[model samples]
Target: MSDYDYVIVGAGAAGCVLAYRLSQDPANRVLLIEAGGGDGHPFIHMPKGLGKILFNPRFLWPFMTEPEAVSNDTGESWARGRVLGGSSAVNGMVWVHGEAANYDRLAELAGADWSWTHIRQAYCELEGHQLGDGPARGGKGPLRISLSDYRSRLTEAMVAAGVAMGLKRAEDVNDPEDGERVGYAPRTIWRGRRQSAATAFLRPARRRPNLTIVTGVTVDRVAVENGRTTGVEGRKDGAAARYTAAKEVLLCAGTIASPAILQRSGIGPAASLRSLGIPVVRDLPAVGANLREHRGIVMQWKVDDRLSQNRDYRGVGLVRSVLRYFAQHKGPMAGGAYDMGAWFKTRPELPIPDGQLLMSPYSFDYGAPSLRVEPSGGFNICVYKLRPDSQGSILIRSRDPADPPVIHARYASDESDRASIPVLVRYARRYVAQAPLRDMVIAETRPGPEFETDAQIFEAYRRFGYGNYHACGTCRMGSDEDAVVDGALNVRGVQGLRVVDASVFPFMLAGNTQAPVMAIAWRAADIVLRESR
Candidate 1:
């Protein structure tokens, strides 16, 4: 008398993959639920339209973090996608597989199943690269990977500058073997449209009768009975609704929502649950702990009008770009966020690149009330620590599931993270000062020439640094008893539940997280299938 053999919550990157893979078996009745509406927005498909729909609450959960000392005691907006494809539909479209060493570390913490070898094989099976298939690349998979279509003299100069600084030029930056390289970034964009997880996986699976998709449903919590998750309880169309799961309930609700959902289900820290007047099922303290994110600061330079794309984003130029995009699906309107990218070591003694830089041909005045392209000619170079040492937490604000959780993003709280800022700024200045870029001769617009000393540079970062939106490690997986999930991703204290997505990452990776989240879900589906049989 079960409604579905498997109930998958949140149709984001991980949820979409799980729904598709699990439903392949006709006997398994799968149900996928999303809190937000569909992904049919015109802006969602247009690669450059991210700036338009990113803050639109209709498509995302506009979660804001709690003010902390490190961030100058000011709360910042955190965007998490609520639509069918989730953040993948709203993200920057950067397709990075992360470093093999990071996954090798996961293998050491969890098991061999999470090793780089398996992850590489999964990438080979999951990607459809524009650059033809080979030993290291996959050309026949569902997700399409293409190089940035937008190119400019400024972007070329940026790459040349990296080469002039001794960084190796890589054909494919996604290649794990290419260490500390610079190149045009690969993206989840194909023929000018965003290749979101819903577009690649869930949409195709919709034809299957066994797969059911429900939107606008706000999941409250898992309905547990005798220490096992029987199903989920939530509100649909302003009425209470419950769905039973015959096999298991998979939580793919991302970092923020996954831990919150578990806490609501009476499965987190015992004292906190009791204080909220909720019955406790398990006393797992790590449910909403160990939050991590990449903190970054943007640097801008006022370039010559001819080399900048500022005009292309405003007035008559914008209208022309729009017309061209609708007619031919080509132009600045179809470009990804960062066209040129690089990884480098801030300190020469470091073994691998400790810092990452992303360059864009266009610049935005983020201090304004609304995000708009700068009226003047300019370009941006953003820098971030690859692996931040600071840790934070997510806790339920109240017993109500409708209330947004409190996000304590303790960014740069560690002394090392603070010290790295000056070094990173110096490295960025050096890169822009090299070769042909030096001739471009643009004055530094952000934290300009006045900020000279290390302390001044650190203060500049403190004033301008922002999260890269790659939040993870909330409900980390490990062999330790305090770990929320086991090596196979099963809830350690629950009988019929699993946490799939970036929340299960033991630590943050070295790059954008969308690609890694999808691959992890693909592997988790295999584990679920194997156990079910």
Candidate 2:
């Protein structure tokens, strides 16, 4: 058995950063464990190569949700990364910091120092964006940011369309002080490769003698005695191993895994854990509750332009595209499927924006197991109900660590969420059919022009919908007794144990969570540092 000052689980986005910052002291020994292999996949680096693993189980958790009553005929499958850098290694590298109100809400709910002002600074300190150019956005940080080298006629048309429609293009999307702005999404990519957290933080920190990274290891649960965490018990290569935490134990296994780990350790809903024959450590009802994610539906259309990825991927053209990427790291193959989008209010009368529109110059066939490629050019416009009213949870289905959790996403359960989908979908159709882009539309692949009725559109939403894959709020932070973690990111009832990940989000942010998760770990490191003092 080995011991360290800090034992962090799940070397995903948060764990990687924690390991990097904690080991800066050289004196502090940090042990990090991951259930997945290291981030060495070819697709893990190429921005567009992600399409290769989108549906593959090689780098994914392959966790599917229970049947959604209102949405699709088939239940949605939740794809999470099992590798180092976790979802960051596998996700669509669109980097977003979320609206300021998102953090303001967390500060109010979690109490003190978590406000937008406090959290925004952490975002700046950890990430450096190319769009920011210099000081306005974070620069000189470990994470790399860049613009896509290739462009499609549809992408050019969409931006021109937005400009034509009285919408302003923002030079910087991550600007906290600037009001609403829509622009090309800046990605976590360096040159042409994905700049995953493992790539930005972990790989560089591994050289430190103070840090030890263990992969292909599964954590059973935290070993708690007398209400204090002693260490963790887990399995590595079919061998049982136990390690003690000299100073603290942090659970960065994400929303689903964090709560599942807590429940297995007897620290969740009392009745639920009791049924599992586990002694209760706390009666935190909100442990696995408050689960929310962005629900998106895509509408695709065929095009005749020379700019579509379809043109670049067809036979001889694909070989040229691959060769270009290999040589200069610049080509259509190096670009992401999506190129532009906007964050806006669902209803003009609403107090704030509640939806996001993502536009892409490539069509992805959802019905197929692999990415859908077409001989004719195609593009997609996706609508997402960003601030959802519906809620669900993740729970332990069995005591086995390998067993997947019972995930009830409950998408569209709320009537508001259900109603918002069609309106947004219709709006997406309107955007596609209106000026600039209207002339380019040869035909609609999903919910074609005839599906005008709300019921029809709702059905289309069910048929074409896929999760934005931004799951959060499982081990929520709150000041209330029912909250799983406190403002400091510490487990409510457990001593010397904390959870630092998307799981600690009291409410899901208004946009993509990758940067926000990095920000949380940035602040968490400070919290851990201060507490240690």
Candidate 3:
């Protein structure tokens, strides 16, 4: 039996950081296990090259949800990172650090110190903005942030369009500490490589003798005795084994896998655990109850000009582009297709922004078996409802570790979420139909005017929309009986076991969760360090 001061499950964004920070003391021994293999691919390092690995089963979890009834949408399949860096290795690399109100609300919902003022300090510490550093904007950190390197005449035109729409030009949206509406997204890219969690936190800590990283090991369950976590049991290289944690077991397995792991370990709803014949250690009904995720539909438009990346990503050109990226990182492949976007308050009077608009130079159809090409260069708009009211759950279907969990993402179940989405979609359509975008585009590829009316819009949302891969809130944080974890993120029913990933968020934040999740992990590290000391 192997023992350590700390064993962190899942070396994703949260796990990687946790392992790195906790092991910083040098005297403390930490073991980091990742279900996925090494982050050896070239695309994994290239910021813009994430598109190359989006659907690869080797790099993604490829989880699908159960069918939903209300919205006519059947179900959605989510792609989560199965690599060393987790989703950060394969994300758009957009570095929007969530709105101020997002943290403010989380603080209010969870407790004190989690407030915006406290959380913002942590955010500033973890991130290093490349565009420009300020009191609330930038500092010396591992994750490098900068504006999109690949700029075109089109990007300027896009800014013009936003101006025409009565939107203010944000100097820098990635500056969360400033609490202002900054424009031009600051991408999570460093030098030329993708600044994933592995690159930022894990790699540096890997040299430490106290930290051991085991890849391709899937942790099935947390070993518990008398309602306290003892260790963990799982398989590796076709052989099963178990390890005991001498100190604590940190579930950094993310929102989806963390809850599922807890359930398989018999720490969830008694009724559900009884069905699986797994002895219920903790009858925590909130294990997977407060599931929340950001969902969005990609709106495509065809353009008359062939100047977009859409024209660049086809046939022989793609091969050449890949070679160019490998040889040197200064090509189109070095940049996220999304060079520009906006965070806006849908209703003018809201205290915080309601939605985020992701702008790309090319259209993307998730349903396409293979990547399709637009005859001419075109633009794609991805509008996401930031503060969704919908909820979902992850349930264990069987005791088997290989079996996929039952994901029922009850999206659009909330009337508010259902109502708010159409408004964003309509706005996206209208924005593209006017001024600079309208002059460049020919027609809308999705929802195509035929899908007008509230019924049709909602139906289309159900049929086509998918998770932003930002699923969170399972094994949520709070102090109530229903909360799986407390304000300190300790699992309520179990001692010496805490969930420190996006799963701890009491509710979903208002943007791409990567940055905010990092901040939470950073704060979590301080908590763990303080307690351990």
Ranking under lDDT, best-scoring first?
1, 2, 3
Estimate the TM-score for candidate 1. 0.98
> Model 1: residues >4 Å from true position, as ranges?
none
Alpha-carbon RMSD to native, per candidate: 1.2, 1.8, 2.1
Provide the lowest-lDDT 10-residue window in model 2.
128-137
**Model 2: lDDT to the true structure:** 0.81
Best candidate, lDDT-wise? 1
For 327-412, candidate 1 gives per-residue lDDT tens digits of 99889988888888899988778766778999998888776799888888889998988888888999897878899999999888
lDDT of 2 by residue, 392-445 (tens): 999998789889899999888888888898788876776676678778888888
Clashes of 2: 1
Choose 1 or 3, whichever is better by TM-score. 1
TM-score of every candidate: 0.98, 0.96, 0.95
**In candidate 1, residue 426 scores what lDDT?**
89
